[model samples]
Target: MIHDTNDAIPHQLIHDALERVISSREIVNSDRKKRFLQFIVKETLAGNADRIKAYTIAIDVFNRDSSFDPISDPVVRIEAGRLRRCLEHYYLAEGAADRLQIIIPKGSYVPQFVMREVAAPTLLRALDDDKQSTSERLPEIVPAEAEFSQAPVAATSSYQPPGTAPSRVPLLKRPRLLAGLCSLLAILTIALAGTTLFQRYQVSVSSRAVPSQVPTLMVLPFENDSSDPAQNMFAKGVTEEVIGALILFKNILVLGADTSFQFRTETALRDAVPNVPIDYVLKGSIDRTEGQIQVNAALLRAADHQYLWSGSFRKDFTSKSMLDLRRDIATQVALILVQPHGVIDKAELQNTVGRPSESLTSYECVLRTREYWRQPNAEMHKQVRTCLERAVRIDPDYADAWAALAFIYTDEARIDFNPSAERPDPTLTALEIARRAVALAPDSPLPLQALGIAHWLRREPALSIAAYEQARVLNPHDSDILADLGRAYSLTGDWEKGIPLIREAFDRNPAQPTWYRLFIALYHYVNGQYAEALAQAQKIGTPNLVYTHVVLAMIYGQTGDRDNADYEVDEILRLYPNFGDKAVFEFERRNIDPAIISRMLDGLRKAGLDMDPDREVANEKD
Candidate 1:
């Protein structure tokens, strides 16, 4: 029988037994029975077999039930005590001579099963010794058979004997012990299953190890201390500058300003650090009163919540330039945060001459441009271009301002926003401005990243990769630089190298705009991996989900789903009426695969979209 334990049992039988136990009136009240049943099911499924200790099992069960109210009712501890008695009776009677024996020993949550082992002489010897000892302990005057026959018959019945208490007899008896063992094992099985099901309901739960060699830090938003509400932007600008400075280190993981700013409303530091496992946190506050500006900052250990270093600085706000003061604070903060790790030496942090200026006006313009860029519409594009132009005009030498201008122009050319205006000659303008930026600050990664983008737009994949590689060396923590490099590698048909880099960027910044997801999908689609491409496209949660639908249409067409593909094409045209041959041609010219183009065109044509003769000729030539 033990050798046949691998045989399958009917699931219906187990379910029926569980239902009967839960509904039985002889045990306890309805509510108590229900709770007990639920706990037993959860335990049997989730409790680790290797760690059978009672306390461990209690903690596991209590943690799962949010309403258990550990302070008020000790449900886990009380249930364990009752379960032990129920199990003892089941094993003694029906299971006494069975090949398989289930036992839930006292002071242990994990159940143990015993089976016949023909080869283990030591085990057999131990069992024989125990039997002899039990026989000797019994009184010699009373015969064993007579004592067995004289045992009360009430033990096997549901009703108790008159004038005798139900709890008087020991639970571990001949016929009743089998029932007790089954009860305990069944309850534990249910408990284990319930716990596993509950854990699966949580969101964003991940178990990833952080590399020991990489340094990680979180920068909190700066506090606003000025009486005038208008001065809030200045403090915000200072916070962003520190983030930008630390991002220049390749061996660091600096949380971006967009994610870090959300922590401002959190009352405690622990509340801000979610799944982002980091080594340190940097916090600061700014005060502006009576024409004076004061900034206070501190570096804290994330594990112990202790302030490792702190400092305060004061300057006359009316006389001293705000940009200069911000630059001083950014440099000081970087030095203090990285000095202990010995990653950024004192000399390197002190040499901040050629770095981008922390001008308040330029900072405001960049912030506004970022907002407009997120809209992804023609009007928003125009607004962002204007803002970026003003940022460059305000601070002509600012490297970040020049980079932003170059990025916007290249994007406009790629998207064909102004096909009638001589294409704006963006390549020439981007190349020249990017070169000037590199000349001003040769070591800074910002200029290098800009140069890489310019080369990428010019179709110089090798040069673009080299520039991005240099940028990565200067600032490994900059997700933007890594993402751009990944894109360049994909465009050059190096999908293997591109996928890992893009995935790392996604892990670091999960809430970025849809542009990253779109690129990742393109990489998969172009490689003929339709399923992977569709999966990634579905992850994108932006208003421009239309792009995902367009990709899906192409995928469906390739896979021979003509009806679904046609429906997708119709929806795209309905949403954007002007979407026509020109729109398709513009997308195709950007090195998008001709196979994808043919599929999309076939779906659109089936949906009543008129094809332009000239555009078809150009596509054929390509």
Candidate 2:
């Protein structure tokens, strides 16, 4: 709904340009410059565009007090000059291909936007294709005058020679026959041309190559322009971060890993993406030379293969700079997609990403873990766990690492991955670790999220809901957190509040994950929509589905689909053969509600599932 201000760059395009500038390696590598860019743009967007001058910038962005003088101290002027040259360099360099141009004119803080022009070659090609199609369809529909023209006849003149005698002569006589014939031809020609043109328009519209829907983005793995191959991580990391950030925009559909997995090189993308209908393709590279680093990136419209925007940023290298670079790119990308209103709250970012990492290993490990966590494969989960463990060991104060570890442990119990008979109790350890994470980073939502999950596993729904609510406050836009909080609300018997939250999650993420599907299915099952719940459960196509199968089994059993229910029960038994045994029952008693336990057992009984070989089901209550 946010529109362009005045005749300036359209609101959406302006956001895309801002994203380009902020993510430019130059901005990401320099924190001060990035902050300056963000504040000035924000101010401009807020309509104080012209009013923002040296004095205000100094006082607001530079933190100069009232005692600061514009004339006496040239901090604002100097910084402004630096900012100007930086922008100029950015556009001429990294931002060269950007469709929108944002300029802070000389001697003014107000920003003006200019949209870039696409290349003529691409335009000409599109036009040629259209003409070819039209020509093919209308080859025989030539104008009637061209097809049947009357030969011109000289006007018959009755006159006498000047020297001889005068004779009756008509100086101007209308050629009635010729005029009438020409008029009739003109009318027919007009009608035929109009019909042909309309048909061309209809054909063009009907044959349009791409689908009309929400715009989609596919971010490719960035190339390493750096001399050292090890530095490729910076580019790859930035690419991953951009994907993460852009996914938050509810309006944009980001193609997840599978569809984008092969897009590693320019050649690969150019060759592969033509077959796929994508709105835009983002490609970038990281270059490091001596102490300075430069990142160059561009967005291309997939339909025409035209570059929409391109930019390069340069900055001096520092460990801290490297650490901040990836996230800054992501934040910038998101802002570009949604614009002024979509600027990620700095406080939330701080809470989620944490302050600069003291240890690179911990940071890198956590990044790798997050990558693996998205995969629905056992190998990926194993890698996720290993990475988290290594990260926490490297930096004991790494709250994100501890939070992830605890979540994984709690998840093992939920999925029966490490059932009671096969493995030692992990719920207590997971709960303790979650507590440690919350104590260490009270401001972070991730740790709070983990704390909530741990409490839920321990059957303390009140504590779980409280933790989830707080987490929601810390990160209001996060879909996963919303869904989790809603699940907690529903589990505590607040279906009215919970259902809306789940619906919001679906709205936010057009391509909801398998986990999301399971959560929604569970909510439906609890609400007694057995058929809907079964349908939702069937949509979970994750390679490592666990608890989803149980939900499916229960839904089927409740709906009297005994064969399917028994099939699911057999799968569960194979996973946890001693599910109803004494050890498992004791563990369940400590962490599960009686009502939930009874419901699960009832469904399984209906599905013809058997008690553990060594124990009677009635003894479990004791």
Candidate 3:
């Protein structure tokens, strides 16, 4: 009914495309994203595209109050970006061969339904038919022109200019023109053929190179071995809860319950489904002893039925509700399996052992960056940076790769990492790269984490904290984000709130870097516990940072150990020769508490560090 062009897309075709996208459990998993897409598509179909503004979406679809301001909140814009990405991924995968495309162009929310371009084989066949018809008509055109030339012109009867061989131009023009056109067509055909071959060769080379990919998982039907028949329902509920929790992790894909429950066991799955695409399968059993229920979970590699990890968790159902018990156990299992440095992450990293850097995919680059964080240094940072740079170049749409690369830039800008290596405007570059990651994956917490670091490097702690809080809301179990938020809060003089966050992070993932230990030491030092602070400081390993030595010197000085304090002060000066001169400036730049900075400088002076600029400058020279 809204047709204004010859090739208007059929309403049924548009609706079919929408169905294909929204029905894809893997692609558009978020109910919010699905709703966003459906609302815009229905609006466009109803000839109300103009009315589909951010305010309208917030009010109608998102259920926001009328007081919502787009500029301030930007929730609509953010979710719109996410929805657009989901649609793009859907088209690239399952909808690749569809006859129509539903695209939401940037800068607007209106959905455009357009007919897909002609298939390559069909287009080539059409071109061949056109060429054949042109060749067949060439003869008739030539004869018609010859007859016209032979008929002669009546107005030229009196022209008697002798010579010129009776004007041979008309006789030779057609053949020469035809020959030139044929030669041009032949050259084009050869060039196109060469280009096609080159492209195919590139594809072949890419295919031969093995790149790491995102791991997929399936939660199989759980077996109930308990006496109570109602425990069967409990086991099913746990499986469903686990599937729900695992789907939140962006790095791993979780197959839906409908698909995963078809087979009872791994062997049945393998025998029934050919070449199962899942990498890991989680299956568990439920058993009740007395008032307590026990859940034993096992993770198995789908390819060979090899068990990767197994754990037993028990909960007292009498003390807690059944729903809460299932959720708690599911969360524990999810955290153990999917968190950073967890089983799947370690397995994936191990799987990248023999792969060359050039063949490393975006996800592999991200995983490698995680390795660098655990053992941060100049050499490893450089290697990680190069890997991530190549990853973004290879796959521009990989948001995690972009985010990881931005983190490197942020470190370089803030810490002056490898100062001898000349670089330009790293701060702005870091922020821009982080923003690019956010734009690429608006709903992902990884990009938001990178954005928070970039903001912190730019000396915007408030904005940094805001980004981190949003990231925590998206994925509360990410320990790295929690530690980062704690660092932010502590640096801004909120130790009461910050220390617990840091402790929680450490409890969640104890295998973190030594820099985290420094925070705990500082927390003790602030509370006037010198022995505790000193003990915590000793656990920090080398290549130790300046802040680590500074804290050590302060704790030793406060505890009346002049020799150890002086040794720490000497280490600091040896590492940073003019630290005394820039110590205050550095502390302020890092957003430390004023009182803490004063106390630190006083302790340093007590430990024989001269705060005088002239003396520090002379020391640097000597």
Root-mean-square deviation (CA) per prediction: 30.3, 31.1, 20.8
Candidate 3, residues 503-582, lDDT tens digits: the string is 88878776656577788888888888888888888987754467778999888878889889889999999777988888
**Runs in model 2 with CA error above 4 Å?**
1-361, 371-378, 416-425, 542-546, 580-599, 611-622
Among these predicted structures, which one has the highest lDDT? 3
TM-score comparison, 2 vs 3, better candidate: 3
Instruction: Put down candidate 2 lDDT per residue, 67-164, tens digits, no spaces.
Output: 87876555565456556766875665345456677777776777777665762232113323433543465444311111100112221112111132
Task: Judge candidate 3 against the unseen true structure and give its global Cα lDDT, from 0 to 1.
Answer: 0.69
Q: Across residues 1-622, which tens digit of lDDT does each residue of candidate 1 receive?
A: 2211233433343344445444432122324335554454434434435553334444554444434443334344445544544343222321233334434455554544445344232211332343254247533421222111112122121111123343444543322344446446645765877653222211111111112223467788888877777567678767867876675453345666655664443234335334445666788889988887999888776667777778888887852366567766776566445522232322222333234333224544444444444445555566556655655543444455565666666666665443325335666456455555554444456656777777667655555677687666555655666777887776555778876788877655443345667668767766678788777866765544356556666666666667777776776666555666575655554544455456556644644456664565234445
Preferred candidate (TM-score higher): 1 or 3 = 3
Ranking by lDDT: 3, 2, 1
Q: Any residue pairs clashing in model 3, and if so which?
A: none
Q: What is the TM-score of each candidate against the true structure?
A: 0.41, 0.42, 0.65
Quote the lDDT for 534 in model 1.
72
lDDT of 1: 0.53
lDDT of 1 at 563: 77
